[model samples]
Target chain A: MIRRLLLFSLLGACSLPAQFGLFLVQNGQDVASSDQTYGFGTKPVGAVVNLEFHLRNSGADAILTDLHLSSTDFQFIPSAPSLPQAVAAGTALDLMVQFRPGKAGAATADLIANGVKLGTFNGIGLASVTVSMGDGSPVPSPLEFGSVKRGESSARTIRISNGENSAVLVNVGTRDKTFQVKPGTSPIPIAAGETATIEIDFVPAADGPQQSALLIDQLVFPLVGTGLEPPFPPPTIDLDRADLASAQQGKLTVRLASPSQATGTGEVDMDIQPSDASANLDSGIQFLSTGTRTATFNVNQGDTVAHFGSDISATFQTGTTAGNIVFTVKLGYFTTTKTLRIAPAVVGLDSSKAQRTSAGLDLLLSAFDNTRSATSMTFTFFDQSGTKLPPGAITVDASAALGQFFTSSDLGGAFSLHAFFPVNGNPGQVDSVEVQIVNSAGTAQTARLPFTTP
Target chain B: MNRAAVFLLCVAPAVAASNFSSPLVGLTGDAQGKLHLVHGVAGSFVVRGAIAGQALDWAFAASGGLLKTADELRVLDAQGNVIGRRTASESQVLLNPRYAFFPETGELWPASAHRDRALLIQSAAVGGRVIALGPADQREIVLAACRGDHLWLLTFDITSGALKHESAPGGTIGEQACQAAHRAALLVLEDRVLLANAHEIVIQTSTGQERRLPIPRNHGTRIHRAGEDTVEIEMSGAPSFVLRFNSEGERLYELPAAEARP
Candidate 1:
């Protein structure tokens, strides 16, 4: 075993000269050791530093093959000779090595040939500018502003510091119109190791998600903000008049206007609450195209003010009694009540005394209510055959051949409204007359009178 | 004997609530012929009596159309009891019936002697169910039938029961893609037939012109007459919607199911 080991050691000594013939040279000087490291210290990020290395063959034989790079940060120049290259004895070949770091960090790689390491190259990447918040914390890559309402502004401060020894000219701007930088100037000069504060304001013009980037020289910091819609104000509803007659129809209008400066949209709920269960209230809203009796409506966006008009009609059962009925209109959280007076049926025609004039038959009417007020009294005349006379054939007079029958005091429910109606047909042909007395509340009562010409 | 009670039988109360899983069959009047009753399917049928009262359950399995004799509608129950009375002629009786339909071949048999003779068209043999039976005009009867996944619109002469017109049998009942057979319903209007599923409504006029109207999809849908020219659609599920449309398929109004109920 000892003799065999001495024989293998002598064989290795014979091959050492052939293996030691390959040498790496930098800048025309041969490197004494293959393990030596070369460093290009603290180069700016994205900066490429080029270096040349020479591979010289000092032995009489042996060629280099399978030459390739292992590091992504290191790239070989295309002008360099192809791999599997051969160098004659006492001859050299040149190759270029480039170090381009993508970010601020240390990069290291080894140059190898045929499974043997040749040399190590090291590099340190330096950032040109460091951006941070106003309070000195590192500025988040995406400066998020979260949600901001439309037509409202939100602001944040960005501190840009020059990390390089030399001063940097940073032209601060935004990629979208939604963001704006205060001071309205470009190319702000930041001293080395010194920071400059720039206020960034985000004012969204529309509702939805918004995105932009803050451009500081060649470095871009993303600006993200989401524009939200503002809360809508409740709708306002109003009635044209509070009090209405029982048989009269009235109008109720609903209006919606945004409290914010921007236009908005929403929906309004409208309904009627009647005070009396016996009162049948009929209401409807006139839509843009057709009228709907529904109590709900929608207001679309971009509508500055939306108006809806509703027609309300009330009806009461037949009775001689008078009372006030309250109708409430609710829109959103607001409510308004209107009181309507249902006038009593206090007027009646007297049938016993009837006189026939040369033109027509005459009839007398009287009011019975002492508390209910009215404005006018209308008398409808019908012939004895129960056929109503046309308006052109009959005439009513409160002061003809008598004092004022329906005076202001009578209208105020202080006295009875004594009125008379004359038929315009021939008295000889008119046998009897039917008179209908109608009050201002549209309540009416009728009586038939026997007619005799005197 | 009371004419007012008979008139009330023809005009029943609207369905305040419905369960789409169970079939609902409405009849014209009670056993005494006092008022109309809306019958819904339950373990025992729910009968809504008197047009405005609470729904009560009835045990008998009763279904049939009202028979018209001169000016009165006489509907008999399965036991030959006079349960329905209304003022309607032979033509008017076809417009809207209290019962679901005249089931000629199903287990439900008509008790009235005049019902079988007055039927304009017999039920189809292939498990066909009558969705609606109404008059297209004074002389013709329009029938809507559902057999499997298809809906058929058939018009027949009122007197002779001769088939006048028939629509092509297919997915013509507004069947949506991948929709099951149990989700569709049919409505017979004055001049058209409405075939509706969860997704759409297909309106086929008496003259064979077809129109399609899209609606929101739901689990189950039911279509019934709201007025002479209006039809009400009820969608069943959480947060259901009730939609009203005219005969021309124009949307009149839409309300949430909760809001639409009395």
Candidate 2:
């Protein structure tokens, strides 16, 4: 084993020639080994200085195999070629070394190639520019400005200090127009050991989350903020009439808090709940002119009220069953409610009156059903000879009477419904009229009333 | 295989390629009523035949003979060359009348602020919103929209700024058919209004006269107006075919020939 080790060492020594030597080039020319010291001059800490050295192989072909530096301050940049690179005789190999000193002082390192000392790398490191908050700590990467109202501005101050012996001129800027550097000069200079303030205003033009970044020389600091909507109070809901009765349909208006001051548009979801949970309120409360059980209303900017139906007021109906209905509306973070009480109905058809005019006949039917409980009302016209007329009979059901029925002045606790019939050719076609009212309770018929077409 | 099958195979790639995907983006027309069916993904768009005799390939999707991207809007001639461009606005520019869509606030404005400016139009309204603008006349502009389960038609008068609207029933013109056009479609010529759903086509007049025409089975999507009055309907399968109608709304031909007004 001792003989084998001696033979291997002799073979390694024989592979290298006596004429083989290495040299570094500066200013495009070769420098002798004793005069080769790469001086990086002065640079700020955390700043990198790259020095390219032309390595000339004067003798036979040789493999670089590996490269090492004595001090940790100097390193090879990522673009440098890999190890074990071959260099032919009379040909040159360009090698690069990066010096990034971490402290404010003189730094030196030796470059070793294939176990041979090639040259010394040296540089003077100075303090870099410092970016910080008002409390004198390093600035965080992403500075959050919380929520800023739309059409309003929120300002923040960032201090930039020059720690190097020389001054530093920085251009404080961001790509986003929402984040503006206000009342400050660009390319502001800070002298050594001195600080300069940059006031950045986050003026949100719209409502939503916003993101941007501050570009300070080669460094990047992120900025984040949210544009909030102005305080939009919940809409005020009101019914057209105070007395809400069963089977009665009316308009419901949802007015905005302040129409002129509105800045943004939004939607409000409506949910209707009856006092009796089992009772279906789907058909009871309709909105948006399409007759939907639940709907979302749009409140536009600078509008007097939210859109409900085809207009600003929605159409709501109380079905046959009388009770209280609670309307709950949700808008953004707010939830509000409005309750409507419906009165029950008393069913009756007391009397009827008929008259004739130049156009035709007008009939008035008096009933005690204030809630329009009668599901169907029919009218039959006859001639003076007691023969049924050619136009047959006409009927008015709950769908029609729900909106037309009104309180009667002739009878106490009664409502009246009016109907008109036209005689086209002859003025004396219809002479008498008979009326029939039907509901779930019972059916009632009124006697024929005499009528003359004048 | 067979002589007939070889002939169909040779002609298939001239109009459609298997690269076509759905749902369709938009269907627009030129001044002469030549229809352009826009489909496929965003960047790799496939516009099926706008200029006459041009091979159907992946190209820019058109809107009223105009092309738009995220930053610029270009006007393309019949030979598919850019004639004009409008890149100065912060809002999204749309052609035919040059409307601007602001992204910061969801609002639309006329580029020139014409007297017929539609201020009440919103990106989304209470019940429905304006989807597509159809052919305009001397005094009015027709808009097709989706309301609830059906399709609706709105006419905006230019001089008076009055808007009149009407809608068909739920099954007449379904919202799905309306939304697949990226919204809705209405072909107008003077007082005549023509619109179609998946099942049928409806023609209405200003005097309240309406007529319904049933579409043939196996027709997939319908695009109105190939010439002056033609309706081009596509049938998608292993081999797709385009069915078209005549001006009198009486004849049906395969592959080409289309016309219908209102």
Candidate 3:
């Protein structure tokens, strides 16, 4: 009899209706209380949607003990009353619910009070904006702009499409001054389903790779680019002749490995340093212009080589006294120089001494010439029979052989040229030798010297 | 003070007779006889002695003294002998209270105020390169820079690291302000900007009102702030002298170069 009594009480509790239920409220007026589900409508992601409702007590006086929301996207307005409040019968309490979707998709939640279902909420979220390359290609997270010349600009365009159902204002910008958004590309409202283009320019003020970001609303797109040094490299100056002669006109060829990509003017200066204090370099060196200590050469755009006089080679006359000329080519931050050792070109053979050994005849010759570099020295040998030998004449490249001797360390004028010659075969067979010396300017020959066997 | 009393008070120590007779050469031939400033001082002063055969473009009073040509910077001692030297290719020179600025390198020396050893103050903060710089006080410097079509006036506080910027449209006044002759002819106060040239001194207020004070026979002149509301105009001549004036354009007194301390 007791078990039957408990079962009756449980059945009576299960048959009772909920005391609190929620009713839709529109524009501060009661709309309906019978609908099971309420739609919050579509909203752009990151936007908020608020739905007003009234929590009405329809059964009897009850204490509202608890409230729960099923989804994190939904929340109760902080201005509402606390839980555990007593509600009189037939009375209604105002309540506000807000839904904020973080991503594009369908969102839903359930409203429950005191272990009883009040209502269900649903909404749709849409992406606010879409971004892509100007050519309709997906933009990489960090858009890379290869190598851009320093002090120059490279531009690219991107398309920003609005995916929202209503017009929305969008702002796009970069924090770095090197990366700039072209004018008239931002701060404009984009209509729904419409697209706009933004031209971004990367003008690196300095050299090296730089990283920055493009901010569109709350979204950040990374960007990267490298600035290359100016394309103009130091030029190379080559002299027509290795050894320049005093009081003589010579050619200097200015060559550049690459073409100039910059527009403007550049100059090449000739700095002269003469060992002789009385040497007047200003009056001697002349190219491009006359009677000037420093000669100027101009470089134009797209020119691989600079022209001074008539061609790539500039004609400059050396001073009467020997000296060193430094040709400096300057283009922006690049500077290159070529030094030419100028000396008198006179060549002479002073004396020749010969000795007989077991191997052959060794000859020591001494000569004095202002220009130490002699182009060639020829030795004509004759046997005791007075007939030319098998190897008629042995020629030596004096200039190449003496190149190592005359270096930047040499500072004296009218240097002496010393040379050794060894004649093979029987020393007794060698009788006489006539030597001829040749240089850039004048050539000199020596009288045939007689040799006697020991 | 009377001119005689001021001269007696500010008379410099006895210098070599050769110092006054030597000829002064400018960076350019045309710049000869023009007035220049010795920045890097507690306050600025005119260079009294001649710097002959140096072909110097500008000079500063720091680490004893420094003179710069187009390609070299030479440090001089109290006895006027070169003690240090370095290769420096600079286009413009800027002076502050304690530091001197050289071109090709945008940095302040003595390395006391900044880190990273570089400051873009020339371009980023001023909108262009600093053409002229003058001391406002012990820790403040007033500078001028030129941008696209505007001239900027910037004041920097050394201790607090605060910077104030003002700009005006470029036209006739802007061109005169940038000239090398008027490099030290700018004085910025709390409410007005003072710019001086050979013929007149222009006073421009923050409210955009402009006033002018004619300077008679003031061919080579430089303007400096003597106090909060007073300014001094130094005229270059046989004997350079400073003419003090109030903000109302009233002449206060004249202090000759011989009487100037720094």
Candidate 4:
């Protein structure tokens, strides 16, 4: 009985319970055994840091279990294996830990296994600031302000937002004198989670594209702007003469004078309009030989005026119809008009009954007075080939000589008058004569007299 | 006297008495008629003789009533500088042979007995023979050439020798028309250049604008600027007629046609 008791005591001593102890192995070394803490260094705010914690069971018989994180900032991804995991003695188990601090401060968490602290994880979050446009859009580098006219200014506002937990001091400026910042002071204070407004102004002194930059402390927001000359005012057009008689020529003028001190450029359009639909006005006017009714003329800087005109020959064909025709001249917003009048009295010559005298030729001319009395008659001679002869070749003898070869009368009715042209040369060689007769109404008529010399 | 001298003496009297009629050869002289031409001994031909000096060797035929010679025409300036030369054909009649105007240069070149090289004014743009040349303005020269159906007017800067403008008046002037243009006379006014032909009168302004004024009754062959605002045009037909016009192309007066004896 004593021998049996001794064997049982030896077995009981050999079969004692295994002690369970946990440690954290980092970089293949026992960090929790040497110290109790693991540092993750400082990181920017809103940044995530990954760390690996190796939990080892240093005891011989017990398994690792009940692994957890004390702080919400420190989390185990995929959760440390189920509680009571069989981690043999002198074996290791891997736990992935993530440190994501929401603010700019130190974050600490305890790594526990089997209700015992394994190690402590410490991380620090940094602070930062960001710049954006006033409209809440991110600031673009080298902002462009397309084209701008001379003496014109443009402005843009920017917001400096402090994204950190602490307030930040911001300074805004530009290297160019053409670019200016509103409030004109540096070190603008912006609270955490708040923004400070800064305005950038680009005033150009000359026309063209310009550039500058906005300095927000160490950060640079490139700025650009263009300067252009102000637009020119429309040109003014005028007619030289306000009234023109039928068969008379007149001139039209286009002047480019702007009261705004701007130089005029581009082309001016001119149009002709007649009061009577039956009266054709364009046919009487000629411009650049490219048709008459409408024309486009150029106006350059320093050049103030251009002139154009047309003869009123077509108005004469309006024949005894007294009316007005208006010429509309337009240059940009400026317009002008001129009036023309056609009268009704007609006076002409009859050349069929031309008689040849011994010394010269006698021409019988008939004058008709429709609205007024016929007053005068004038005569001219041309060869069959339309050449002007010498003055000594012919002599004119009229009853009432108004001038050298004109006869003056006040015949109210249609009357036939005699004008003698004494040819110094042979009358047999006579070709043709032209007669122009005028009435008291300032109306004139012309007729060509073809003669057969006998 | 010798036989030749006696023959010359016998013809001299008749030559001095012969009266030159229409289409007469124009004589060159100063306003005082100091260097006028006297009749030769023979009536069939006339020699260039000064009024109070020895006679010249140049003689022209008197039968055609126009200047005709087998030699070329040489035009000289007042200082006796040669200006132009032209070869005269048998069919060509020299009108106003004593004085001719180089309308291209607006220079009055006088005819001389001397021979010189001719200055031919031309333009490739026209592509045809130059029918007329005149001044478009005081500083510009105009050349009018006629081809098959084209009438081209080319203006050149006189000082720079550069072509400033070119325009082709749309119309087909046939070969007959070209001949008529050759016989036409040119007159340059202050603002217009008048070219009078046998068929029509073409007036071109200093601004390169052209207008063809038709003579419905008769054909014009000569033109002369009578006054600042007047142009005298002469017809080509038997009954001599003269038409006067103002600068604006208005007919002022027309003289009755008369028989011209040649």
Candidate 5:
């Protein structure tokens, strides 16, 4: 050992208290990756990554002592070589070191190199290599640890409706010991446009506010392997705009609020409960009449509304979405809330009647509002035999002015020519007139008259 | 208003809207048995048995000869009776008293009494014509007759008021490729003419829209009638010309090849 130490390192000039320690790159390019580097991945448990390293000239000065590299995770592929001699020469001609990775996590090992027996450098040459181990996933959507309202269990299906790419496997986990998970697995592969279900069962410790992690791991997309999931997206929820008001003008006009449905056509579960059920003075709303209700109004294409007005003020019940609805109210003037529904129907055409025109028949029409005020009404003529007549002009009533004539300009394919009437409903009342339908041959027929109040 | 008032005021006296739309399709004819007509649309109505106490009725879906214009057909003083006929022709067919001959599908003189500018329309294409009677010493003469595919109009002499018949140019003579039954005289339905070009069919419609119907290769001219108002056309094989289509093309019908209207 003395002669060998002399020949080992010829330089013994400058030195520290006891030379220094070592950290070896080991004898490896890691080409096959069998030579373990300080990285985390698949690992053979307990099997050391056989590797070694030795020191040449560690520094400018000659080192004083035997050098060796060792660790619990590493050793020579063959075995530990004999202790090396040093200090004769200023430096070593050849040097080598070796090592292997430990468990798949941050591993630590001290590389003992160029240390004397009674030297502090024994532990001083400590170097630790850390590699993190994990099951990778990114941007995975997940649900809470099967925690949902008792009645809303079906809503617990994890929604992956908006996934752009398919995933190989999705990992659902819970870190909480108390919150158990089912279908213990990760990375359930799914094709594009497919959804995967991860069933889990949980029982709260106390039924109160139970909290636990719903971990998502090992998400494999089209070509990507598992990676850490992106930070969870901010929470979201459904929002509704609530606005309530009393029916306008002692009247209740119900109409389809949507293009597809008219008023009174939709389902409405409503009740007029008295704030004070014991208050015997108040009777719940009873219905008097449904009024004139017509149906088959094309929701967007047709108009459907129901109108009602009363002396008492009351609240109406309806669905959350806007559009067609039924109206229910109290029967009499003085009463509690009552419900009435005009089976969804489209009422009077919103358009006003136009001015005068003739169709070879002597007929006239008049319309009015509730106040007995005169309003314009459309008049049509038919030959004596009730056959539709062609176009002719009729004098306009002096009472109504040309308020941008309903302009019966084109009767379309209807034989009767059209003219706009400009009557003000505030003056008098009139509805419509029908020319005689009987032929003018030998017999004479009476003309038909049509009228309305409001 | 109270309940009764509201009820009375809001409700209108309901009047059942009458579904009266169609009109009487019949028209009265004239005092004399001079003229007759069907729909301005050139269709023929048979002199079916009487109904509603009348001898004739204007039937729907009638079949008949082609009229160049709607104004040319009329109902005279008698209701539903055909009256004096008129046709808008590019050339005038002068009627007079003379003897002429038709060579297209040879026939002889015809006889009838018509007071107006009655045309002794010697059958050049489809139907025959009416003639005028002459003087006391002799009986009315019947000289030239109808020759199908072309006409020889014999205009009577104006001065003496006699049969002064003469031959004049009528118009082109051919059938549409699809339904050649209805003859064409240039004036009938020119706008409905669909030209079969080297590769396609093109039609100039009445609404001033031009439409080109796609035709498969190796198709020939075969106009098919599918309904009272619809027509379908197909070509044979590898159309030698461009296909053209037109819906405005006047509709024409005719007897079979054996009965080429004379």
Candidate 6:
């Protein structure tokens, strides 16, 4: 009977032994590993997948012990992870259970935290689970950028989807000044269950510059996803600057006057402020009635600190004409106000002075005072039409018969004098006369040869 | 002991005197002009010229009192003199180092580093056959020289690797041979091709042509024309200066020693 009793005690001791178990941990939320139910892809060479697990104190008291298990494909968390406070009852700690994807193909691995046979606790303490890692479908893809023109506006959009349980942020930017993309109000937040579309507009200010980089960022729970986490698209992009000119009425020309670097076909955002307005009133630029005139736009080089102005000219029509526009654009952190003054329209033709035979000829233009402040002036030329030449600014009058010159239309050119209406291509000779100028101040000064043709 | 003798042998007084004062005669316009003057210890100097806006090439080298051709510019000694002067062709003075140009080949028999050496392409000669005389490692010649009476041009062919020579009638070139290292010259024109020696300019054309030239005895050059024969040769001013006939000969103009411009 003693022997039987000892045997029974031994059986009891065997049954009452401490038990242990190990399990899997957290994986990304809603990882739809299309083919694999466990949400794992083909484990490429040298891939590690961290599986998360939760541990609970099911024992009546805080059971402190080391966990031990055997598996080549699995790994345990910090050894003897902080033991939960002496559990008065059935309290628990959601400790992490990690399982890294091993090699490709079907593989199995066991994980151990402390020294313990994790399988031994299957029916007693907890349960043990096996994990497999492999390469799978449903991986995040990249975004592509399209072409844009110089001096013109264009836009593009990248589509990114969140296949995980958590939301993610998408950011966009480039380093080159040749292109500018409209910044969004805030980082685009894409929900795990939804897709976010990013809109990027670019205006290339220079030529041949490219725009690249569209990034997706967010936290990814370990063990929940397949394949690589958050891959980046090719940042290098091809920015085509084929369209430099606007199709509309006016021509806008922007140039980099300093640094002497050659800019290619593209529009770049330079100074923050807009272009100068008064550039249209340039005076020194006078176009020939029969040919194209010279108009220029000026810019000051940042290096020399000297100011340069560009001049442009167009033949006078009923209205204003346009030429290559120079951008006196005030850009960047500093805004400099450029002054553009309308130079007095050129009075001289190809030549300033002309020699004619003494055979009293008809002069074309009536000379007037240059100092005249009023919008309109009535000046008179002597019947003899002879005046001594003087220096200084003078004006031209329309009605006064300074000389007889004619063309079909009003062609803006230096005033000339002639006896007959222009029959052929010639526009007669130049006309000159002495004139008096009257201003609002009642000040009068006379300049000689107010309107003389070159 | 041999090195000392070699040093003295190399140190011998430079014999080739650069005629810098003479102007290139018979050349017209900037394209066919004389090569600029250069003073070097020793090395190959490129002679670039233009005639009617066309370019030409001429290269030369000088060594220990003996001029030679080179593939790459020969290394210079401590005094900046050509270390080794290349000796090529039987008629080195007139062949390798072109004395004059041949109408058939347009090749300068003898070429000059600046004036006398074996340069494939000459800046003052025509453009055609380009040959080079530098290193044996080179497969072809490197320079081409074409000289016309009114045209002087030279070209450098990074390709073909050769130098040729060409010329026209009534044109003046540097017909002198350089015998010393570090010696360089200029091809200038006045009444005709004249060589500047020390302070005096020696006429390369026949003495008869020199007698008729306006270049008077004891007269100095004020200005020079680079191979321009279109307009009459006029040398004006000075008591010793007289209207003399500028003789014509196939003479090469050498740069004079460094001095103030006349």
How do the residues A1-454 of candidate 1 rate in per-residue lDDT, one tens digit apiece? 8985665455433332334233445667865554457675656667899877766656654455545566867776755467444555676667778888655557887777656666677886655777788898877878988899777889999888777676656668999779999867987877778888889999988888788999875567888888976654555555556643322224445454564344532333323332333322222111111222234434445543343322222111111124554444444444545444544544432113356666444442222332233333333334557664444123233222112221312111212222233323354444454443334445444444556554
User: Ten residues in a row with the worst lDDT in model 3 chain A?
Assistant: A408-417
Who is ahead in TM-score, 1 or 3?
1
Instruction: Give the poorly placed runs of model 1, Cα more than 4 Å off.
Output: A1-127, A134-147, A167-196, A202-228, A238-244, A247-251, A258-294, A306-443, A446-454, B1-262
Deviation (Å) of A28 in candidate 4: 22
* Residue-by-residue lDDT tens digits, candidate 2, B68-99: 44455444442344566555334332223333
Any runs in candidate 2 off by more than 4 Å, and if so which? A1-50, A53-128, A147-155, A164-167, A191-193, A201-211, A225-231, A240-249, A259-285, A300-304, A308-310, A318-326, A339-454, B1-262
Residue A272, candidate 2: C-alpha displacement in angstroms: 8.5
Name the top TM-score candidate.
Answer: 2
Ordered list by TM-score, greatest first:
2, 1, 4, 3, 5, 6
TM-score to true structure, per model: 0.35, 0.35, 0.29, 0.32, 0.23, 0.22
lDDT scores of the candidates, listed in order = 0.47, 0.52, 0.56, 0.47, 0.27, 0.27
- Can you write out model 5's per-residue Cα lDDT over A206-293, one digit (the tens) per residue? 3334544555442211111111111111111111213321111122333332322112222112232322222111111111121112
* Residues B67-124 of candidate 6: C-alpha lDDT, one tens digit per residue: 2232222223312234443433333221211222332433443222432433333332
Clashing pairs in 3: B10-B259
Clashes of each: 0, 5, 1, 32, 153, 188
- lDDT tens digits, residue span A1-454, model 3: 7885565455434432387778888877766646678888777687898888888888776666667778877778865468556666798878889888755557888888867778888986655888899998988889887789977888878888988776767778887888898764656578888998888788887788988888776567888999876767567887888866553456677777778665444566666676555332133344423323344566666788876544566555453335677778676677888887865555543234455657555554434344544566676667678876645655655554344433321212222332333334345766776777776567777777677443
Cα displacement (angstroms), candidate 2, residue A56, comes to: 12
State the TM-score, rounded to 2 decimals, of chain A in model 4.
Answer: 0.36
Judged by DockQ cut-offs, the docking class of candidate 2 is incorrect
Error of 5 at A286 (Å): 27
For A1-454, candidate 6 gives per-residue lDDT tens digits of 8996665455434331132223334453322223222322333324554444434444444343344345444444554364312322344444443344332234443334333333311111101111111122232232223344443545454455544455544443444333333555444565765665544455554445354443333221111111111111111111122222111111223334343222112211111111223212222122112111222223322221111122121111111112232223332322223222212221211101121223322222211111112222222322224532122222433222211211211221112222211112121222443334333334333333333221
State which candidate, 1 or 5, has the greater TM-score. 1
Ranking, lDDT, top scorer first:
3, 2, 1, 4, 6, 5
Docking class of 1: incorrect
